[model samples]
Target: MPSQPPIPPLLSPYLSTAPSASLTLLTSTLGATSNWLILRFICAALKNTSSEDGSTKGDNEATTVVLVSWLRDATFWKDGGRKLGINFQKVHIIDALTTGLGIGASSLADVETEILKAITTAKPTTRVEGEERVLLVLDGLDFLLAATSCSTLETLDLVGELREHVYTTLLTSAADLPLTQSPTTPLEISHTALIMTMVHQARLVMSAKSLDTGVARDVSGVLRICKGAGAGDKAQEGEGELEEREFLYFVGADGGVRVFERGA
Candidate 1:
């Protein structure tokens, strides 16, 4: 396996914005290659915020991550846990693909219900003070959107609900209120509240797809920030126009995801 690439610094502007809700869509024709890469990225990111014991350190904050996958099995993630040094105990994985075996959800509705339950359970509440964060990862959204049992509208509605819930919960948190009511505060001035504000202003949509052109050694696809959010001030300089940014990436021998500009 190729060594995994370092987390793209470009993502820092987005991921560092805690207490903000953002949705990143990973798509590819490479049979879950992009999904796996993204999963690894998230695990790596979360691991940075934790201690050697897997407990969150500093910031008095906790991140609850729930992954809903209609593909792969526990074994797949188990491998990731070992390689990434991630404590799976802190991550909730829901297998939604198995059927007739009494192991997974039976239908689309069942899947939705399970996801909702997971999100609700993982989200931080008033009982847990301090900065609470939730990261919900939905793998195989294309499958759900294409399933005959679930209408497109229904799928979209579910995503909308999830986004709204995440946004509301994070924004209403005591630590985040100043970002909304006191925009001039140090935190607000420093754009500490930028991510939350972005989440409130628009939904983020990202897509990953295979590119026929070679981007780098062993690299096969490009990821694009298609809609919903922008590159912050840089994007705003376009006179209210948001320009889409694209990146070419590949999974290295170490199972790490490496990303770079399309032509770089």
Candidate 2:
């Protein structure tokens, strides 16, 4: 378990300053999913614990979060969130995993409507008082391609529209060999299109997978962070491109993650 912050130092900047109108893609293989990392993001975002780098914030300072999980139920997140002291009241979770999102283009539109409603529930009336910073998180949205009849382009459009209402967007999906290597099947092809298109739109790309060199006693997996196609378009004044980097991470039984440079 980590003794420091839940958000490892290596990832803090990107999480805090991911530009608006951008996306952050968390790609995971079957052997190493990004659910654990997503939780850390949620923990930092909701309760947030601290921005002083050492101190904490009052309830009023919390960031509004809209979570849409297509692969896990409400119980799974609530239970895990409890471990991290997440304030569930501040988080709006849309659980599409338990039931179903239906099975066609119209169904996809209905799904989109539900997501928009959840995002704006707090201040549906206005942005006049001030702009609210709401983060939108979608876990396993790729599941839609396989479960429904929607095309990849249509699903991507849904993501684009959702980004309009939120402060930032982060999503997780499969990036296994078949999908990333050279997808050939219809589903794989669509899934690959979804991921690659996102890469072109995401400012930060965080991918997790087992060590290619095989098993290790201390390391469970590796993480790679790199700027995506979207990063270049949104570079702020004096802020240059982020250096590409990698780290080895170990997840403890207690569910804390420790990330560090290799050979550290």
Candidate 3:
């Protein structure tokens, strides 16, 4: 186990906080996966679930995570969670990769059904006092578009429907240059459209990609966090837009991730 906590102090504000009724978008690449960052979101949200004496907190401070993945298995996330001292078994999992959502018109519906089912039948530990806010994490949703023939709009509708059941929704997808900049094929077009639409709807957008200066012993990649189109709706009465921030992060051999501002 690593000595450091999963949620770094500098990254806590952005990783731990998820506004209610908002969407957060996480963009990653094959070279710089966001799995590490996603785990921090889980840790931070559930951090206040219990007090020092192991007593359950009220609904106001509790959070439950429901993870649905199309590109990875439950074990992959669970094992990672363990390294962070988190019990990922408590996280509701919808394994699209294993069960297969299938192709065509009904795929999106099936996706939505699975997610709602998970939330409906979650364990008691996940529901504090009465109702605990759920953070629905959808990993690799773009894979659904490429694997199935569902249009971007249909998949997006599924997103909206899922949001109605959870406090907030976090989505992850590949945003490589080809998919976002030079999309030409049908699959690419749909993937790009879906990502673009989500960006406009998301309150926070965090993008992870490899460093342009190449790999280094102390640096893993660069992470960019910015407010989205929906952010302005929640801004203070006289406040300006939220500032976009960037950081450099490194993942250690012991599965501990360190996220810090540039040059720190």
Candidate 4:
């Protein structure tokens, strides 16, 4: 019966280069929207790529499937905060687990099961000759320790290692292959369109200062990403060339900035 955290507002502007084709992300405050996006992408990619073609068009899927696991609680930190260098009461990880508020955060096993199920759904019949495309949409990854009140740094380390394994073994391996050139004969243009849309939604969530910033900027970003994989595309495609230019401004947490500004 943990209380829900306030859903942050959208701060980033929407990209609108491709109107007819765009990915807009809205959830009932449930974190599973990310899981759904990932699942859908995998399925679509499977359907799109010929089981006979040994190539994947998308990036690493495992890395995309991020999980925020909480291993400790506040009571453990009742003592003065000395281990983590932060106050536990200030940011309760359990609050992120309320089923309705967002995707129910769970343990490593739970996350693994969910991801495995998704992967199974898009299983490749011809392993050596088929490419399975998928993207994981994990948000708020930094909140993994939000609930742990005790010094469960060891547990945190374990989770981090687990994430790396999945990413390196499954996602990275997939990305290493040349799947983009493999023409998808069984999938629809709409399918690829949908996956691209999801990626755009993720970008918006990552870039926005808040959630309610209007889908305008987010939509614009989606279009721009779809039209061109990167943020730099000059075509006045989705919204306008100007909007596309603005989507490049990425503000990371303090002391951590992305290479956006020129010559940074």
Candidate 5:
């Protein structure tokens, strides 16, 4: 198969964080779709190896991506993953929405428990070395907000709990290795850097929404980094801050996601 296209440079910074689970809140208009963006992110994460130049060096361990989706089924992701040239096996899909089948969660707490269990089990333990990074993709928070019948505060609390669980794991087992055995590339260093360098933890949170006024073919939409947990201080020194940035992107005829600065 041909090599997958590189993610647009504008979006690369979001996914280049040290290996750790993180929560990204994706808020979009009722009809606008963010599935393509999620798929693109998965492709980018899986394609990242120890090589900073985007080449395969050393052992090319495939990243494990567990997608807990409340909006779609396994087949939907399997097809999308194939189109992106990503190994479908690396993408695990869990179905959390069951209203259409007439069987739904009995309570909001039950739903929260199920989600937490799925994420906790998906996290890789540090007992083994050279384990690939894991990326947890929660596809539809809006669906959960609606289906659970929970108050806004209650739902937000659940999100907070999920975030804590997802973002606190070992970035990479390589961090435990001796200096003589450390890898040198930026990507490798980010994972296996010294304990001092490991203090900061960053993760990408992207949100997409449709333009209030736009023709169907135009497909105008907004994309922005909600916030990456440990990125604020680092970003302030140079890139301003992640939360202050936003972009305009659209879906193309070929199913590719193209992004452009909102006002540039």
Candidate 6:
């Protein structure tokens, strides 16, 4: 294993916050634009239930879809703080990377459950046909690598567990599309467009695409799924664009830690 180089201080705006009893949070400094775009999308998805007629209802029953961000990056928080907007009553930003990884085993499940509960509680009083999605945005997984002491294999196992749980849950409830799959494959398509649409509406916040080698596989799969779901066609017709990343960690084939970034 190799030591992690000091993360450039200039990049602090993008990384998660360091460990602390309390953080000096500056909401005004955060990047609110991305967060606002996401919020608006969620609102739009909920408001408009029809893809053909493009009809929508009022925002009277609209509830804030909980935004769960996992990152130790101050920039992510800052951006979120500034952009989360008035659509949400509360924003729970966990600043400590160490605490997030320490609780990593259960954190994914807990977050997923909380989002589902929030959505269920909202109950939009109409059949949510194409998609009814809850977006889970994760930033700064690089920090997760820094925080986790486990071997690379162990980390992969943990991540796999989280992925399985989420995919299974979404499939069972027919909620949301799994967008990371390749957009060209037919087998990957499902009735998850509303989920993908809502996620897009939420400004592309879910980090389901971790950059492990498996991440490539996942991305390929999601592309296939989304393409199969007609997302590719839709996107081409000026409907949307795909902005997903592959997951990566600081480990190798032999479970050794190393610092590397994509396109480097």
Clashes of each: 7, 0, 0, 42, 1, 39
TM-score of each candidate structure, all chains considered together = 0.64, 0.90, 0.88, 0.27, 0.64, 0.32
Model 1 residue runs over 4 Å out of place are: 1-6, 44-61, 99-105, 124-130, 167-202, 214-217, 229-244, 262-264
Candidate 4 local accuracy as lDDT? 0.27
Candidate 6 on 180-223: residue-level lDDT in tens? 23433322232123234323322113221222244342121110
Model 2 TM-score, 2 decimals: 0.90
lDDT string, candidate 2, 1-264, tens digits: 435555677766555555556688999998888888888777666544446451335442536778898888989888877776778887888888776653443488898999899887843233455545677899988998777788998999899999988878998998999776878888988998999999998888999999999988789899998888888867764337467889898887777778889999
**In candidate 1, what are the lDDT values of residues 161-218, reduced to their tens digit?**
7766543221111112333446574434333343343333443444555665544456
Steric clash count of candidate 2: 0
Q: How much lDDT does each candidate structure score?
A: 0.51, 0.78, 0.78, 0.27, 0.54, 0.30
TM-score of 6: 0.32
Question: Candidate 2 — which pairs collide?
Answer: none
- Candidate numbers, best TM-score first, in rank order: 2, 3, 5, 1, 6, 4
Which is the winner by TM-score between candidate 4 and candidate 5?
5
Location of the lowest summed lDDT over 10 successive residues in candidate 2: 53-62
Error of 1 at 203 (Å): 3.8
Off by over 4 Å in 6: 1-57, 60-64, 72-86, 89-131, 150-264
Over all chains combined, what TM-score does candidate 4 have?
0.27
For 70-177, candidate 3 gives per-residue lDDT tens digits of 888888888888887666645787777777754454467777777888887652343346456888999988898888777888888889898988888899989999
Q: Residue 180's C-alpha lDDT in candidate 6?
A: 26
Compared with the true structure, the alpha-carbon lDDT of candidate 6 equals 0.30
Tens-digit per-residue lDDT, 1-264, candidate 5: 223354655766654443444444344444556777677667766675544544323322436666767677877777776777776656666775543221263566765677666665655555565453567666554344444444445645555566565542222111223321465754333333322232233344455666657654545577766554555545544534344468887676566666778556
